[model samples]
Structure formats: structure tokens, C-alpha cells
Target: MTSRPLSILDVRSAGPAGRALCVEETAVFQHPLLEDPPASAASAEDRRRYAILQRRAEQTCLACPLLAGCLYDAVVRHDVAGYVGGTTARERARIRTLLGITVEPENLDTLAGVIGGNRPVDHDEVVRLRAAHPDESLERLAHRLGCSLSTVKRHLRRDRNGGRTREQEPRSRPSVRAVLATARTVLDPARGSRRAA
Candidate 1:
């Protein structure tokens, strides 16, 4: 599929509270895609910069409150840009295939804009898909679910071990922006100076 820019939000549905806790407000605004793309033609330093940027972008997403919502939207709409829910556009397509959700023209509409129009991937579908394809590799399963392989393993293992997937529990304390900054500095202290805006 051709890459196209998505609004990320079709509406301010999550509102201020959800928006405030978003990780995009941190490092992602610097690049069009959430992460910088590595190019073989580029210098070694350039490749390293891209890698650092991608890692920090992922770390920011991990700390966001609306991660689930962001991921769900990306998977449902076949988002064509950025690291959403830690999955790329190709991964989202795999998920859409697994969930049996056809991407109709109107699938682009936000859930807030039109209720009951899109089918988001659900936990049950994930479980069912895993069960139906028991021999499938965890990475394949994660790609199908638009999640990390570890997550696929965790959910299935947790269930088998008699534990439910944990909810997005409230995080205890600390500023997200500050934490994000610290992570970036740790990864590459001179990122700003090393790369020109």
C-alpha cells in the first residue's frame, strides 16, 4: 500500500485528558514518520541516529495512556505512517487480515465520528486466532495481532497459567516528558547538536 499521511486522530475524541498523556507530544513531532528511517546510502552516524530515534519513539509510546486506543485505530484503519502501538503499516494489514475486518472506504472514519462502523481487534479474536493456529510462530501471531511477540506469548501464557491480561493500570508517578528526555539523552546525549533541524 502507498504511504499516506493520516491525521492520527480523525477527531479530538480522546479529548484533553487522553491527549495530555500521549507520548507523541514528546519526541515524535520531530519526524514525519514516528521514527527516522535508516538508509543504507547514509553515513554510519545517520543510521545510528535513526536507530536511537526509533527506540525513543517506542519508549514514549510504551508510557502513553492512550496506547491501546492509538494501536486500535492504526490496526482498524491500516495507518500508513509512524510507529503506532509499536507496529508498522504492514503489521496493521496483517492484523486486519487476521481479524477478518475489511477495510471499506469508510473504515477511515473515526469511531467517535461514527459509532459501530469499524471492527477493532478484540482479545477474544486474538485468543481464537492463536488457538486455531497453535503451530504458528509467536512472531507471526504478533504480526497478525498488531502486537509484540512477547505480548502474544504473555497473553497466551498468562491464560494458560491462570492469569488475565493486565489492564492499563494507573502509573504511579513521574513526568512523561522528563522521562522521555532522560531516555533520549542516555541513548544519544548529543542528538540535537549532532543532527541539524
Candidate 2:
């Protein structure tokens, strides 16, 4: 059987699906899908801006044409880091939940440079641990892992990149933004409505 093609907007339009994408999109912004940031930016505002960038990236993914392919690749490979097809670490978890798989496919090798020879944690696991231990600090965990504090914090941060705490629990259902996006499309398939707007 052939799998249905997914849209970046579709990933974000489905309440549960979109929120999951938001989590991964948040990671891509904090750590970047490309390169890691310099160690000097330990300030609070700098981190805040980095989060903003992640949310913007999710928005970008929502608008991209290849989002379906990206999501497929991410799912097949079990990617545990960065944004793909507008989905976040949390979003991927939802996918896993849907598929009923437990193993992860995203390589931890992408973290080689960021952790300075330390084996870094994957984004999905980080989300789980953060959820499991809401009182813990990502920085403290990184210290124990012998990696940069930012790297740890980046994993814990939500995909939305809003001012919310990294440890906040996710909604059991789709978010309002996601429902609106789908509803708008259903109402009028001609004109476009931004998902994260």
C-alpha cells in the first residue's frame, strides 16, 4: 500500500500533528538544521531570539512544497534532531505514537561538533526526559553529559519557540492554531491561510 502524501500545512493543520511539528521546528531554530552557534551567546535574550527563529522556521516549513517528503524521510529514518517538514521533536513523538514504533532513526552523529566529543542525546529522547523531569535543568543535564549547556537547553525547548518553559506539558489534543489552519483550508481551498499565523 502507498502512503499518503503529507503537506507541511497538513502536518501543522492537524491539531496533534502540527503541534508535534512545532516541537521539532523549535529545535531546528535553537540548534539550527545547519551549523551550531558560537559559545559566547549565553545571554537570556540571545536564547530568546534563537527561539523566535525556530518558530519562524516552522512557519517556513509549513509553507514549503517538499514538506511531505521531508516528513517521510524524517519518519522512515527516525530523525531525532532539527526541523524537517515543519515537525519538531515532540511532533515526531506523536508520529511514533501513531505508528506504534519505539526505536529512533535520527543519527546522534549530527551532534558531534556541538557536544565536543561527547555523545549527545537525540531530540525525541530529550523531549521525553524533559517531560518526565520537568523540574530538571537542561543546562545541568548538559553539565552531567559533558556537553554545552545550550545544546541541552536547545533539546528541551518547545518547537513553537515562544516564551513558554521547555518543561511545559503538551496538550492531549490539537492546538487551536492547528484547527484553524485546517478549518480555513476546508472552508476555502483557493486562497492560502498561514498555519502558524
Candidate 3:
């Protein structure tokens, strides 16, 4: 059976909270300000608009029942885009850095077709590619597969472990509440500067 690539909607719907506010209200949540940080030379008006949009998006996220789950997934599981869990991509990156955590970068090209790429590389495909090119490094495989090195490793590891996915294993990462608390500390200017000092 041919399986279609999972879209953001598919993933969101599969979660316990049904669908996210961002998915329903794309205009406010998926604005460029939330998806990508403003350029360094952005005008004052642009900066003002970004701040407003950020606040709006954050409010929307804060109202969602899935905020914690969404935030944890974005910060700890997938390098997703747009405003998620009341934070921008850059903010999530900062939180990950402060937490000393790194997530596998999503194959955005596969997801959006922005770079003319196709669907995600499945486990079977990864195994076939590895068998076809026994001598190729994991990095090369990742490049050819349009995925991250960690994704390649994950697939291989899952195959070796008899199909037990990461979710089935014990997690060593911090809880969502802990991550949120850390985010507040890191993003608050007063607290952040005090901690840095």
C-alpha cells in the first residue's frame, strides 16, 4: 500500500487535542513574522507589526489545550516552522539551546515542496538505500534522502531494535512544564540578563 506523506494537519489531528489553533487560523499564526524572523534591516513599522503579530499568536497558543504538547513536540521532537506553542522558531531554538537539547531537523522541502522535494523517506526506503550503497556514509545517505543525519540514524536504530520506536522507550528529556518554565526564564529580558550575569 502506498502511503501519503503526513501533513501538518494529519499530525495535529492524530494528537489528543484534535487540531491546533494555528491550523484553523493560518493568517494570524502563520504570518511571516512568526514563520521567519524579521531581517536585521527591517523598518520600525515592520518591527512594530511583528511585535503585534507575535503577541496575537502567543495569545492564541496560550488559549489552546494542546499548547504544552505542541511546544514539546516543536522544541524537542521536530524542528517545525511558524509560531507554535506561543513561541517563534527562533525562540524555540533558543529554548533548545538553553536546555542543551537538539532535535532532528525536519525535511521541510519534503513537507512544503518549497525546494521541489518529495515525501519523507520511510523506514523501508532507508533500509533499501543502505543496502544499495553499503559503503556510503550516513551523512551522504541523509543528503540523498533529503533528511537529517539524526533521521537516518533513527531509522537504522529502529530497524535494529525490532521496530520499537522512540516513543516506546523511556524518555530522559524534561517535562513540558519544565520546558515552559525554562522558556519563560530565558525569554524574559530581566531574568535572562540576570542569569547571564
Candidate 4:
């Protein structure tokens, strides 16, 4: 019942077009320029250097086929570090604020479940664990079930909702394309300059 968090695997599953340029150009994305900008008191030379690198990173992202998916995941699902999807972490926070969305920090314990090559936890197992330990914390329940916290949550939510999946639940949320468009607005030079002024 728990879907895996959006990852490079999800990106690659989209086929050849999903092969992210960032994966191929790992060093480029890891450069200091792709990270947060220099401090305000940084020398002009450092700032200038950052600008050059930023542009290069942006260009690389722009050329990527997975830009939309990457941007959507970065903004909505994961609080990633460094430059990704043509936006900085700060920009992503702004986008989330503007869209009135929040992403929960994933539990570190669940990371192993994400890529640990473990078998998917069954819904019945989650329910049984909860029944057996009615007073236990959800985190504890997850630990007992050997699954991610999100997976535990999902299964519980489904059980509470008469086994309806998340997709079956009616909720209003922006589309990936809408999020991508909002990112463009967030990264707009004119808007940024206005904010600076």
C-alpha cells in the first residue's frame, strides 16, 4: 500500500527520456555553484564565479528530459540538497509556500526500506502489528513491520478509509506541469531582481 518515494529509479522507469542528465553529469551537479550561493559578504569575484556556474547548471538542467519530473519530485516529495531541476533549495521552498504545500521529512529508518532491496510490506501485516500493539507509536509500528513510516501511514489510512487508495480519495492538488510552470516563475530573472531590490 505504500508507494516508494520518488527516486532515480522512478525517473529511469520512464525509459530513455527519463535518464536524467544529472545522473550522467554527476560532477557538474555537485559543483559548489549548484549549491547555495556564496554568502552575502562574499567577495565580488566569488559571486561572479557562482553566477557563471549557476548558468552552466541551469543550462544542463534545461537540456534534461527529466526536468519536469525532477522538479516536481524535488518540490513536492523530497527536500533535496544542492541544485536540482534548475532551482535551488530556497527556490523550492518558495514554490512550496506559494502553492501552499508541505513535504514531510522522510524518516531515516525508512531509507533502507526505500532502496534496501527488502520485500514490500503487506497491508495485513501493518494492520496486525497495529492490533497487537495498540498503544505503540507509529514509528514503533513501522519498526515492527519492517517497513517505512510512510508505508505504515498509507496502510493505516487506507484501512481507515474502507480500503480506498490515495488516488481514489478526492483531493485538490496542482499538477506536475503547474508546479513546473510555477518553478519558472520562481526562477525568473526579473522577479528575482525585483525581490533583491
Best by TM-score: 3
- 10-61 in candidate 4: lDDT tens per residue? 2332224567777777776776445545767777997898877766776777
Clashes of 2: 10
List lDDT for all candidates, in order. Answer: 0.48, 0.48, 0.66, 0.65
Residues 73-145 of candidate 2: C-alpha lDDT, one tens digit per residue: 5544444455455555545555645544443332243545655465556666666666777555555565555
Give the runs in model 3 whose Cα sits over 4 Å from its true position: 1-18, 111-172, 189-197
Number of clashing residue pairs in every model? 0, 10, 0, 0
lDDT of 3: 0.66
Cα lDDT tens digits, model 3, 86-159, are 66776787888788776655545455664345656688999889889976666688788877655676677568
Q: Evaluate residue 122 in candidate 3 and report its C-alpha lDDT on the 0 to 100 scale.
A: 84
| lDDT score of residue 148 within candidate 1 | 48
Which candidate leads in lDDT? 3
The order by descending lDDT is: 3, 4, 2, 1
Error of 2 at 44 (Å): 14
Error (Å) of candidate 4 at residue 114 is 14
Q: What is the lDDT of residue 124 in candidate 2?
A: 64
Writing each residue's lDDT as its tens digit, candidate 1 over 1-197 gives: 22122222122223334662333355553453333244467679867766666666656655565655566555554333446654554455455544445342222223343324544445566688888997665568768776544345445645674655332222332233332222232224355234434
Please, what is the TM-score per model? 0.37, 0.38, 0.56, 0.53
